[model samples]
Structure formats: structure tokens, C-alpha cells
Target: MSDAQTQKVLDHIDADFDNSLQRLFALLRIKSISADPAFAGDCKAAADHLAGDIASLGFDARVRPTAGHPAVVAKSNGKGNGGGARPHVLFYGHYDVQPVDPLNLWHRPPFEPVVTDHADGRKIIVARGAEDDKGQLMTFIEACRAWKSATGSLPLDITFLIEGEEEVGSKNFAPFLAANKDELKADYALVCDTGMWDPNTPAITTSLRGLVYDEVRIKAARRDLHSGLFGGAARNPIRVLTYILGGLFDENGHITIPGFYDGVKDLPPDILAQWKKLNLTPETFLKPVGLSIPAGEKGRLLIEQVSSRPTCSINGIVGGYTGEGSKTVIPAEASAKISFRLVEGQDPAKIRKAFRDYVTARIPGDCKVEFGDHSMAPAIALPWDMKALSAAKKALTEEWGREAVLFGSGGSIPVVADFKKTLGLESLLVGFGLDDDNIHSPNEKYDLKSFHKGIRSWARILAELAALPR
Candidate 1:
């Protein structure tokens, strides 16, 4: 774990990354799309390949079956210099890639991997799962390989619990963890699905917003009506739905839901000052999206607008209408898909109820309302006082040659909360995904630099974690 020993491993990483890229290419070519049943065998192949690759580094590795695809688990003792003491780290990543749709957008077959230059002159490796997972997961494994090759053994207790079903919402991962709680238990979990703040700025994701996805349908007049016959007498459910959704946010762009802010607290002054130093503003955040407004709670910073405040959004809506030009028809029903980004301590069930109640209260007599469930998960804000995080921050800073910035991302992993609840483990998210990775999109790519540096970064992290005074 000393600098001299760490240097030898790092040098090995720099020398061996070409081989790492080849390994990752092999993985990326596997077509492990877990959401579709047609790719089941491919998912199993990816799992087995990863398990076998991991076994080559001397861990006890296996590809175990779940109700879904399968999960790869590998374990090694974290005995520093044979001291028999250190933190046991459980690393999590997904081996499956998102389904590649709109295939026409890709320059090559989505499963055919190649390193090509981006339009901007940067070298990027293209494939379906390059950045989403295969690349990200292999960074960690390659780091371990370097450590094993250079130092003869790993520096700390480590286990890899990579699964094939993350693209499908980890439907079977929780049950798998619950079933094998004892074997998978570890001191901390390391997740590589998030990203850096920017290419040069290292980031540690501190908070992830929760989600409540709901669909509401309103029935009126029981059947489609002719506008000429029922124009003024009957209420148009589409109009009513618009008013209801439009009212969720008001003049200053705050959610009008009662008690929405009940659990929200302002950031501390020191943190606010730090955020100010980062210079994250509406212009920088919005310009890329073709917007320039702080469309959330008034007086709060743009960072808070995204990371802290609860938000309401209508994802989609539909009602009866003509397919072509003019069919003046009144719809029997109108429906909209609504989702809320929840903050820490906001109960998903309570928010879901409050939303339904708001709709019910606003509905007129003789109108029937029904709801459909999409998904729900509460926000997660990891504890900062842990020694592992402290060491990790320092090590990442050393690797990037700059201070690592802790951030509050506006998305949720869902499985992080599940890991904590089911295995009593805390997770540290460190990743190399950038805003332009085009994850879950056609022509997805992972920067060659991200892949190379990501492996070296994990090398530094592993050595630094081994040095922690446990």
C-alpha cells in the first residue's frame, strides 16, 4: 500500500491497458441485453465470461443463477502484506447493456466493437454497452489484474457482485442478495454506474433523488362524444387533466403540492459556499438542453433546483382525438403519465397517495379516476463520516491531480437503497461516465481516456483502501 509498491502496480496498469481494452471489447460484443427474454442465453454467457475472467485473478468466482439472468460473485481476502486485517469491499456493476433501438443511428453494428476517433478528435471506443457497463465493470477488474500481476496479491478484502439484470431494474438482484445475505456481506459497497463532474474534475456522487412514477386516467361521459352534441354541456377530460397537471407548478416554478417541502432543509453555509465556488448556474446547465430558466423552487440555487427540491413532471399524456385532420370528437377518457423526483426523507408511498388524493379532490362528480403504477424508490444520501470515503476522496484527488468534488446527482440507482437495506452495506459511487456517453442511446461510446484512466484510478483506490487503518 505504500507509494513505492503502489507505483509498481500503477506502472503495470499503464503497460497492460491495451490488453484490458481487448478484454472489454470481448465483453462488449456479448449482446447481454437482460430486459428481453430473447437475450437470456447471451446474458448467461456474459455472466460466465466475467466470472471466468475474475477467476483468472485468483478469486473464488462463480456465475450463479437467479430467477432472471445470473450474477457473478468473486471473493478474495483483503489481507494487507498478510496482516489479515482491512476493510472488506464489495464492488457492484452491471454486465448487461441497454437494448439498442433505432439501430439506424449507429455507424456500425451495435455489438461490433471498435476504437474510433470522435468527431471532435478524441479517441472513443464504440459498441452497444461500452460505457453503460462492460467498460465500466472491466475497469475495476483490470485494476485488480494489475495489482495481482505486480504485487502478487490484492491489497484488501474484495468481492465483485456483478449482475446481468440491472438493465431490467435488478428484478432478481434483491431476492438474490436476500437469499445469500451472509456470503455477500461486506463492510462497504463500491458502485461504478455514476460519473465525474467533468472530464478533469473528479466527482463523488453524494445524493441521488428518488422517484415515484404514476399514471392517472380520468373517465367522463362514459363514451366518446361528438363535439357538436356535447361541446358545452360535458367537461373535456383532456382540458381538466391539463389544468390539474399545469397547477402542480405555479408562477415561481415551485411545486404547489402541500407539504412537498416538509422534509427539505437548506444546505449548510460552508457547503453553499463550496457550491458557489463550483459556479454551476442555469446558463451552464440549461444551455445544452436549449433552456435558460431556473424552473424550480424560488430563491434556491440552480444546483438545488435539480438536486434538492422535489419535482413533478408529466412524462406523457394521451386522450381520444382524430388520427388525421378534423374529427371533432370528445374523448371518453384522458390519461397522463406523471413522475416526481423525490428528495431525501420524502416517503414515496405518502407522495403517491397525496398525488392521487389531489386528483380525486379536483375531479368533478360523475367522473371516475383510476391510477397505474410505474415504479417507486426513495432518495439516498450516503454518510460522509466514514473512514473509507475519506481515504477514497483523498486517493481519487491524488489520481486526478485535483480535489475530488462531491455532488448531488438528480437520479437514483434504486439498488443502492436496496443494498443498504438488505445487506447493511454503505456504497461509494465512483465512475468515469461523462454527459456525452450517450448511454441507453444508439452509437454509445466510452472515451479511451475514461477507460484507461478509470482502470488506473481504481488501482490507486484499491491501494489507498488497503492502507486505511482499520
Candidate 2:
């Protein structure tokens, strides 16, 4: 594939973009909310619609049943050049979307897809799943359509594994992958479920923080006691719980757990320097959230603290009770939900154990501490020198005329780990979403330019991947 051919495909994308938007509209109109059982048929409809649409592009596509919702698997018929093996990629996205609650907050009907002007004068496609997996995934599908339409076949072999349950934690998709591992084999996987750094800047997510969620309950007295009666003699569980949690961090803002940083490592000097150039400051990143302090590991850059470093947070705590005025009673038990954002080299199970141990060690002789596990997933860090990552970065730079930022995201996408674990494939994460796209919220939208250029970016990426050495 030559540069001329790539340009021809990009040209085809520009000419057919309106039809592309219409196709995305068709998808956005479906109310495929996976979290609700009432929308199960809609999820099936979404899977069937995508499979049939993708199959028209010379791919063997089908809607296969999973434990919950169905998943669409599409394989391109294109063989490598001269009938040799070509670089194969498994493209992953989700067709299911978050449920639209608080319907009155929406300016328009949630499923009635429409192009509207944003307050900033940007043209946006407004609907559920707009910047989410639906609009984002269509960029690649349309890119493939352009390639087949312009060049008679794709530049490489491609397989699409679009699922309908990502919004609901993808509990069954991992088993589905394990069950169909052979058919999903690929050199690597391509995921378009992340966001760019800003509207103008493209990004390739290089790492994702893992998660460990736990709940701890502290019980002192067998029953609630009058504050006057137990003020001096009784052990208050709320006070004990807060004190234990408060000590989890030290004066330097580092986690105080004995082995919390055991396996944690620092970012390479070169990457740290690159992050410095990004200039993620409190004014820009934190001010909007009514915060101005870099609260984690004080010496690290704001970007590093949020994206690359590990941290803990107490999500919720409940203990005493108060009515309209006040209740003069000490609660019998106090419980709190705590979560840790873990980095690479940090095991989720180890972190969970350390946290629980730390809390249990501080309990008084008469008090009891019980723990409950919620969820755990390990961090994912892609090899910095991966050829596919390099190829995709170069292609994105060419498409956007800006160097794509390779940054770690503070959030976790559990399926990325599953891809590596079940299918033995590293993932290349690229996406066209922006921070203010309002994804999973009322009036969710995707910028028209993101939808348009995202197609061009994927087109270039496909060409770049095909040209990589076998």
C-alpha cells in the first residue's frame, strides 16, 4: 500500500462522511441500554444491526450469543498481499450504552439522534452513546468501508469483536473471549474506548491504573448507646474507623501502608520530561473541580500524580445517625467503602490484603473489624516500544498534524487486561472522545469533527499497520 492509496481512501472518507454520520445515527437511535433488562431486545437489535452492516463490507460477520448480551464477530475476507499472511488486528468496541436516567434533563429525546450546535459553536452529534463506543467504533468501521470501496479490499486482515455489555462491566465478555480464543487471534488488539488529551490533541493511552475496592466495618459496642451514658466509658466505632483511615497517608502525601509502594516504580526520565512539557497544572486540571492542590505524592507532577501514580480514596462512610435536629447516640457499627487506584507492578490482591491488614491491626481488643471484598483488577502497562503503538502514533500524528501524546490514564478499562490474559495480545488504545463530551450523562455528544477525522485517523492507522514488518 502506497501513500497515494492511503490518500485515495482518505478522500473517499471525506466524500462519504455524511452517509457515515447517517449510519451512526441509525445506531444511536437504538435504545440498547445493557444495565436494564427491559432493553435486552434492543441490545440484540444493536448487535444484529452492526453485524449486518459490517458483513456488507466483505467480512464474515455474525452475532454470537454470550452469557448475557450477544457479541458481533466480523472477519475481513482480505488476504495478505500475494496471498501471504498480513498483519492481523482485533478491533474491539461496545455497542451497548449507559442507561439514560433523569430524562427530563435532556434537551432532546435521548434516542432521537440529531446534529446540534454546541455553545462553543462546535457541531456535535447529540444522543446516547454519541462519543462513547457507538460513535467511536463507527469511525473504524467507516474507515474499513472506505478502504474496501476505494482499493477493492482492506490493506490487511482484520477481525472486529464488538460486544454489547461493556457499559455493564463486561462480566461475560471475558468468558466469551476465553471460549472463543482461537477465532479471535491477532497480532494485537485495537481499542477505541479512550479519550484524547483535548479536542485538538490526539492521544494513545499507554497505561491504565487498576482498581481494588473494599469495604471495612468496625464494631465496638453490641448496640447503640446513649452519648451521655457511653461518652466516657464506651468505644465509639466511628472515631476508631476515621482514625485508622486518616493514618493511611503520611505527611508527604504518600500512602502509609507498609508495602504499598513495594512494587511501584517511577516513570522513565524521558517520559517524565515529555509529561513536563504537557504542563498539566492545578489551574487547568483541578481548578474546575474546586480543588487547587496536588494532593498525591507531593513532589510528582500533577499529570504523574493523577495518571501514573497509585492512590487511595475513601468513597463513602456511614456510622452515626441524625434526624431533623440531632441524635445523642453512638452508633454500634461503622463501615466505609475504600478503593485504591493501582499502578503497574502493584498486585490488586496484595494491595487489598495490605489495606485490610493495616486496618485490622489498629482495632482495639474489644472491637471487631470485618472486611468485605468488592472488586479487583490489575493495572495494564503496554510496552513503550511496541511496533503497533509506534505505527499508530505516527499515523495519528500524520492525520491530526500533532504529535500524539502517549500518556497513562488514571481510569481502568478491565477488558484491556482480559485481552492480554485470554488472547495473549497487547492493546493499542486510540480514541476521539473529549473531556466535556458528557459521556454517560444527559445530552451526551460527539464532536462532528471527531467523528469525521476519527475515520481518517483509523484509515491511516490501518495503512500503517499493514506496512509493519511481519
Candidate 3:
């Protein structure tokens, strides 16, 4: 296809932008919360809805069953394995969303998708899944729709692997991939579940932090005791737990876990220089959330502390509680949820063992500590010199009229590792989400400009990919 032909498809995307938004809104209305079992039927409904929607655009689509929630697989190939002449690309996204707890924080209903004005006057799409995998995924689908509508077919062989179990750690989706690896094979994968640098600046995630989640429980005395009778005489599990977990951090905000940073390394000097120029000050990042401190390692840039360094966090803790008033009792047990965000070269199993060792040594003779493993995965770093990366950078730069920033994301997408391990395929992560999108939080939104320009950006990228040498 010529450049002019791609331009025609871009023009179509611009002209039919409203219908594209309507399609996205339709998908967003489905309550596919995979974490909660009550929404199981809704998760299947979401898969069916997305399969039909993709089938409408001239692909063979199906809602395949998994051990848990269902997944949708759609393919657009003209014949004989998509003619075997053009490059094959697989696009991955998720239809499931985070559970909408604390619903009172939302300005409107979580499932009622609507375009509204931001406090600063920018138009935004407000809903639970907006700017997450749902809204970001549609950008690629809408681009494909434009290409098919304008010129009869996509520039390359396209396959879509949309799952309904991402937010729940994708425990079942990896097995689903193994069951269908032969069918999902492609030259490369495109993942649209990441974020841009800022609202105006586009970015492609080059590296991702790994994750190790643990649930620790400390048990002592075997029963609750009245504080009046057992005060300072009996063991308090909560105090012991808090004391140990609190010591996980020290005066300089460094994780006190031994050998936690053994494999972690600093970014190269060239990349460090580039990050310094970006200048992600606390005033711009932290101030929005009523904070003014970079709470990670001391003497590191805010960007490094967030995106490149290893750290640990206590996500939740619970021991004893009263319904409304005060309960003066010494609890027999206490537990806390801990997570470690690991950088490149760190080992998840090693980190998990180290954490357990650190906690076990501190347990008193009267107490026992039990751990429940939740998740563990190592980090991913894509080489910066891939030809597809160049194509995407050029295409994003053209759409945003500014250079696209390439940086490591502090978040983890474990499926990226699965894609590599299972299919032997590398993934290119691109999306238009912003830091303030509140994805997984209340009042989540997707900037209207991101939705519109994101479609156009993918349209150009598809053309560029098709033109690259195989």
C-alpha cells in the first residue's frame, strides 16, 4: 500500500470519530469485573459482546472458554494463512476491569460511560474501564475499522487476543494461551495496556518492573485476650507484625530486606542524561495527589525512584477491629499484604525467599508466621533498537507532533512475560493513558484527545509496519 492510501484511511478515522466513541462506550457499559465471582456472567457477556463486535468488522471471532473468565480470539486474514505475503501481527487487550469499590467517590455511575469536561476543561470519557485496557484497546480496533472501511482490508494480517481476566492477575489466561498457541502465533504482538509519558507527550514502554506479592500472617496465643487482664503480659501479634514490617524501611526510605537490591543496577549514563532532561519534579507528579515528597530511595531522581528502582510497600494490614466503638482486646493473629516492585535482573523467587526469611527470624518463640503466595514475576526489558520500535516512534511522533518518550514503567504486566515464554514473540507496548487517568481508581477517565489521536497513531503505525522489511 502506498502512503496516499494510508492517508485516506487516516482521513476516514478522523471523519467517523463519533461512531468510534459510541462503539467504545458500548463495550464500557458491560460490568466485567473478573476479581469478583458475582460478575462471572457479566465477564462472559463482555467476551461475547467483544467477539461479535470484532466479527462485524470482517474477522472470524469466537468467545473461547477458560478455566475462569472467557477470552475472545479474532482473526482477519484473506486466505492461505493471510496470503502468507504480509506480516502477521497479534493485538492483545483485556475487556475486564478493576472492581469498583468505594463507588461513592465516583461522580457518576461506574458503568455509565460518558464524555465530560475535566476540571481544567479538557474533554474526557468517564467510566471504570476508560483509559485502561478497554478504551486503549479500542484505539487499535478503531484504526483497523477505518482501514477496512476505507480500503477493503487491513495492511497486515491482524489477530486480536482479548481476555476477560487481566485485572485478576490473568491466572487462567496463560493456560488458555498454551491451549491455543498454535492459532495465536504471529510475527510480533502489540499490547495497548500501558501509558504515555504525560497528557501531551506520547511514550512507548521499554521496560516493566516485576512483582512479588505476599500475604503474611502472624499468630500468637491462639485466642483474643482482654486487654485489662493481659495488658503487657500476653503477646500482641499486631505489635510484633507492625514492628517487623515497619523495620522493612529505614531512615532513608531504602528497603531493609537483605540482598533485595543485589541484582538491581543503575540506568546507563546516556539514558540517565535523557531522564534528567525530562525533569519529573515532585511538584508536577506528587502535588496532584496532595503529596510533595518523593518517598523512594534518597538522592535518586523522581523518575528513577518510580520507574527504575526496586522498592517494597505494605498495601494492607488487619489484625483487630471494632464495628463502631472501641474494643480493648489483644488479637491472636495479624496479617499484612506486602508487594515488591523489582527492577531488571532481580529474581522473584529469590526476593520472595529473602522476605520470608527476614520475617521468620523476627518471630517470637510463642508466635508462628505463615505466608500465602499471591504473585511472582521477573521484570521485562525490550531492546531499544528493534525495527518495529523505530516505526512506532516515528508514527507516534508524527501524530503528537513531538518526540515520543521511551521509558521504563514502574508497573508490571505479567502477561508480557507469558507472551514471550509461550509464543516466543516480543511485544511492543503502546497506549495513550496518562498518569492522572485514575485507571483502577474511582472517577477513571480517558482523555478525548488520546482516544481520537490514538486511533490515528495506530493507523499510521500499521502502515509503517506493513512497509517494513520482513
**Model 2 / residue 117 / CA error / Å:** 0.8
Candidate 2 clashing pairs? none
lDDT of 1 at 434: 88
Residue 460 in candidate 2, Cα distance off native in Å: 0.2
Clashes of each: 2, 0, 0
> Which lDDT tens digits does candidate 3 get at residues 1-470?
69889889989998999999999999999999999999999999999998998999999988898888888889897331333778888899999999999999999999999999999999999999998879999999999999999999889899999998889878898899998888888888899988888888999998899999999999999799999999999999999999999999999999998999897878889888989999999998899889998898898999999899998999999998757899999999999999999988899999999999999999988899999979888898887678999999999998899998989999899999898889987899999998789988999999999999999999999998998776
| Best model number under lDDT | 2
Give stretches of model 1 more than 4 Å off: 78-84
Stretches of candidate 2 off by over 4 Å are 78-84
Pitting candidate 1 against candidate 2, the one with the higher lDDT is 2
Candidate 3: which pairs clash? none
TM-score ranking, high to low: 2, 1, 3
Candidate 2, residues 253-288, lDDT tens digits: the string is 999998999889999999999999999999999999
Q: What's the true lDDT of residue 128 in model 2?
A: 97
Q: Spell out the clash pairs found in candidate 1.
A: 78-156, 78-157
Query: Local distance difference test, per candidate?
Result: 0.86, 0.93, 0.91
Per-candidate TM equals 0.96, 0.98, 0.90
